[model samples]
Target: MQSQPHVPGFTIRLADAEGGQEQEGAPKATRGFRRRRRNRHGRGLRGELMLPNLPGFRSRSERFDDMVLDSAERLQDMWGKQLDGVLFAVDEIPPNLEQLVAEGTAAPMGSCTPGGRGEAPMVTVYRRVVEQTATGREELQDLVHDVVVEYTAEMLGVPPETLDPVYRRRYQ
Candidate 1:
């Protein structure tokens, strides 16, 4: 019989059909068996190696950041030069209780800071609040886009409908 390939800390043994051992070396079979056994119970060496390659592996905060950036890019396409001085940002959540109390709300989805004296205006989207408010993936995308549009419109001193003709279409 052909011998099995050698692995670290493993030895292969071949046996006759009668279940008698033909050759034995260092209990090598146990190494492979150990690996299989570990994986069967939970994540093991194999899972560690493959985890980084799996789709949708980014953390929740990272995914939220991606959504914010993507929403900004789409708005940039629509606004062009008008968006040149706007700085887009994402925070896990808004700052302390002061701001929440000031707004008279339990959650604030986004905020805008008008720049002064050579500084660019900044728009901050609250990741955790927006994410928690969304019911699903498509809703999340729409909500993020809405927040961006609203903040940009406020920065430009225009209404959201003026910024995008199709802003918030329900049936379309």
Candidate 2:
């Protein structure tokens, strides 16, 4: 390396022969490399995700929408009628529900049982439990589906296949 005589009190800048930040002798593809692409839903697609609403879960995607459906839809599809609208406990869930909530807080799932005569069945769904259990929307959806199907069937005292299969077909 040749050391040019230093000019006193002068700041010197060196420019790379190649473009900025490229490794030495790196092959240059076209300057017009693709940046990225976003669909109407604002979700980015690299190759083959097949997801519709990329940025947000809700949108025109059938899969995403199905994931968001309430447990009522599961019962309605299975039994051919919507079970009374889904109700969750505003108060804290019982100990039994805590275990289930540990499974998923975002999609916490549970059911209410009858307190006594004139008291409605308390199909309790623990939101905190579900949230704690879930990692993301997809996981939450799956957790909700599994918990709802299992809990509802248990409350009705029927085999899962007896009710679950019917609704699974309808929703699918």
Clashing pairs in 1: 11-28
lDDT of each residue in 1-172, candidate 2, tens digit only: 1111342322111212111247769896543222346555786655644344465433323332244244445455446433443332322234555564677643334554643564433444444456567788666676656666766667667776776664344335
lDDT of each: 0.68, 0.47
Candidate 1 per-residue lDDT, tens place, 28-141, comes to: 345544236466666655544436567655567667666766766666666666776567777666778577778797877888888888666778888878888989988988
Deviating ranges (above 4 Å) for candidate 1: 1-53, 98-104
Q: How does residue 139 of candidate 1 score in lDDT? A: 90
TM value for model 1: 0.64
